[model samples]
Target chain A: MKSREKEISKIEEVLIRFHRRHETFQAPPFWTERLMARVRGEKMRGNGFYRAGAVVWRFASVTCLAAVLLALYASGLNVETPYEIVELMFDDPAGLDLALLFASL
Target chain B: MAHSDKETQDFEIIARIMGGDVNAFELLVERYRPLIFGIVMKHVPYDRVEDVAQESFLEIFRSLGSYAAKSPFSHWLSKITVRCCYDFWRQHRNNPEQVLSSLTEDSQQWVDTMLAGRSRDAFEREASGREAREILNHAMARLSAEDRMVLTLVHLDGRSVREASDLLGWSQISVKVRAHRSRGKLRKVISGLLDGRQESI
Candidate 1:
């Protein structure tokens, strides 16, 4: 198998080199401009999509966060103030609001 | 400046492009035109090779900012080139004749000159040896895309079996085994063609 592999490689190399040397080279030079144009077009198109995605994600996030904050504001579950909520975990035995939040969701 | 020197200058241009300077991407394109074209020609038809090659370069530019820089630049470029050429093949799957057009005339001329005794005589020292290879390429075209890609990536491109495996995202064992199998298939086809050629002769 090794010898045969080598024989095949030798034959292929000769054929390729022969093909390469005799092949007349021609590729349209203007393709550089064409390609660059396409690149720029795609870049613009991608940026447009990115901007649109950014807007959607931000709106969704802000809306969700705002809904959470607004619900908390509306609930009026004041033991006293916003700082009182932070202390609730450590001190407040009351778990009623937690149950209410889950039930609402 | 010399082409290589100019090409080296492109790294700086690429750095800027990666830094969000879109204009610098053009320099990378101008610098690597022939290299990308050469890679494309290996798989694409002779006519559509240029645009497809250009598409690869654009993909490289658009995505370069996310590149990990762990791999060699050409390997990264070659990955995109392979993918773009595959896309070209997919679009042209219904018609193989439209593969790559930029080099159709030259390629036809190339085939004509090759099949004739004119170019064969140059390798007269090894003319008898050349017949098998021409047959091999013909046989190669008949293989499935998966087979053809594994064969080209390993054999024609001189990539390591491991590297070819990595490029194609197959296990190294699979690459080695598939490469071995494809060679047997190629040899069988070449032998068949040789028998037919000899009978005609």
Candidate 2:
């Protein structure tokens, strides 16, 4: 059994060496152009999806920013506290009453 | 090109591609096509080499946004290319039509000559024949895709366990264990062949 293992190991090394001696292949002529055309086609297909996604993201971001800026502008941007900003953004009547009470205090 | 300069250029090209100049990708493909082909050729069937390499490059381009640049670009590229070859084998692993090439008489002679303990130089000279490739491929076909990848990376490619693990995204222990088992499997396959040839005599 031990001798068998040794023989296998020897053969494995030889075989690996043999395998390594195989010449490295060069890319066939004009293969890069063929590959590039495929890449460009794939990117074109992908860009449609990406462009739609970008539009959605841009719209969401602009709407959010515009809403925030409009609120700050309408409230005079002088609402110093986060509580005031939240009050401007939401209709929590009880919280509004609490803020009024705090202001009076 | 200097190594650092090449890396800088690769990063510059990657940045340009990410910045919406997709045409900049041609530079990268041109630079690494040889490296990618060399790797893919070793891992995939000869006929599928171009297909697999093309797929690898597309994958690299798609995932360019995720590259963090901590590791060298070439190492990352190698990992992706190797993974593409692995995927190729995985996809084909279940095909019923996958046939092992028969070992030829010349391959049998090559094996006999190898086992007969000729000098190292003589062995090296004769081992480059097409028969040796056929015999190796015959045995390698029996291994699972994972085992085949590990054996090729470690045994045939002469990569260390650490390097193989990095390239394979496998734990070192897994790579080490798989390498040993795959080698044993290969040995058994070859041994069976040798025994069969002897019985036929």
Candidate 3:
């Protein structure tokens, strides 16, 4: 048992020394620059996707709004007062009649 | 006091990076490059150390937002570096022949002496520092990536099993079992190398 312990100790010492010897490494001066450039490239690529998505979303939103207005106009609804049309489209006509009756009174 | 100061500084830098200040990340890279490179060098071949180290940093940066700062930044960085090394070995695991053929002449001699069971004193006196490193590296290359990682962390780096478990995301018992098995495998490899060398002699 004692001999085994001694062997283990010797191995541990050797390993510790070996580990310490490798604690310092010399990286090139431009390593940080290269890494930064790569990171920036990654960021730009990510932003490209984000910007493309934003543009698509904006275009789709505008197109949808325009389509809705075109449909309302084509249906012979008033295009100048779009909210009134929207209210008439969505609200109960009885509610609108009641609101108009109140306004008249 | 010093530890907390470092933690605070790391937190500040991390916040800046997450806030989209790209330049702030350079400070982190400069501060930890040696540490990351040193750990990476232990697991990878010398020729590939730079590439592996860079990959590790890139991984760390990409995952920067997920860093909880619950542990020291160095510890968290080390976990990423170790995983990078593991990934490297996984990609190159089939190329054991390449690793064996890359050893220097001096390292080959040192391995012969170690296999012969020479006294530690003799090894210390006779082996060049570079040769010692090479022999260890060669021995490590013979083991699986998991074995190399567990042995280096638990035995060589003197990390506790709990620390290793946390770093590896393994149960403590699992780490202990793997560590024991890895040490035995390392010793067996050394003995086998010595036997092969003796036959060649």
Candidate 4:
């Protein structure tokens, strides 16, 4: 009798679930059409936007690498310049010249 | 004149949608609207439900191409819908409280009296059922969004704790604990509401 009662309860739950499902309307008619259009548009938007972004990123990376290379070459090539020589003198102000010390010796 | 079979998985429809078949996505929209609407309606005001529901669909569409088919499509779609609903909720300035839904014209009165009366017990239960549901609904509104969602999915929707966890993208342990706690909370709130209702009567 207890087992029978459990079965009855389970059936009641199933009936409740059935009522819930039956009572609600699904999507309205026109929304489905609208959603389809929107989905297509969204897909197009993703492809268009992301592709454009990818191109921009590629350009940016290349530009960044080129700028770094140019900076390195410019600094490396500056060793023989008069301004560089003066800048070196200023850079070593804490150290005295070896030639002046040798002449005194 | 053909409707897509409901039994087919989402990935199948999605593949067609990507290949530029617009109607495939329509099938998807039809299939999931109720599920999406259920989640969104809980978080948003009546004014926002339609638009937010649409936005949730859009979000799903926008990200559909990136869908990896790892989880079932419904689970993935549910996460997007929940996030969209939350965003709508967050955008509201007045500290938002969730409310149990009452019927409007658009609300489906799904319980047909004829069928509902088929079982004498159910018929007797029906009059009191709405009151019970109403109490639970308002009581549910006072809970946190996560708790509200966990409760709805498990109790109202009749999903397994595991399925609810999947729907919410929550871990099994967390889902179980939340479900247990939310029930206790609901029980307490419901009893209070019932007591108050009786006193008022």
- Please identify which of the two predictions, 3 or 4, would achieve the higher TM-score against the true structure: 3
**What share of the reference contacts survives in each candidate?**
0.23, 0.50, 0.36, 0.25
Candidate 2 on B1-201: residue-level lDDT in tens? Answer: 345988999989999888878889999998988889889988988888988998999999888888988888988999999999999999989888888767778777777777788897887876776777788889988999999999999989999999999998999999999999998899898888777667766
Query: Could you tell me every candidate's TM-score relative to the true structure?
Result: 0.67, 0.81, 0.70, 0.61
User: What is the alpha-carbon lDDT of model 2 when measured against the actual structure?
Assistant: 0.84
Can you write out model 1's per-residue Cα lDDT over B36-138, one digit (the tens) per residue? 8777877765566766876788788778867765665676787788877767656655665633222223323333333444544654544333443344446
- Please give the distance, in angstroms, between residue B62's alpha carbon in candidate 2 and its true position after superposition: 1.2
Best by DockQ: 2
DockQ of each: 0.21, 0.43, 0.25, 0.16
List of clashing residue pairs for candidate 2: none
Please give, as one word, the docking class of candidate 4. incorrect
| Cα lDDT of model 1 by residue, A27-99, tens digit | 6867667777777788788778878998999899878985686457445665566566566644536656556
Stretches off by above 4 angstroms in model 1 are A1-25, A58-61, A71-105, B1-12, B18-20, B94-137
Each candidate: what lDDT? Answer: 0.63, 0.84, 0.74, 0.62
Candidate structures ordered by DockQ, highest first: 2, 3, 1, 4
Report the candidate with higher TM-score, 2 versus 4.
2
Winner on DockQ (1 vs 3): 3
Between candidates 1 and 4, the DockQ winner: 1
State the weakest 10-residue window (summed lDDT) of model 1 chain B: B99-108
Backbone steric clashes in candidate 1, count: 8
Sort all candidates by lDDT, best to worst: 2, 3, 1, 4
Could you give candidate 4's per-residue lDDT for residues B1-201 as a string of tens digits?
A: 332354356667888877767667777877788888877765555456778889999888778878876666777888898777656644542453543444332112322332233576665455344433443445556677777677767765677988877666789889889888877676665344334433544
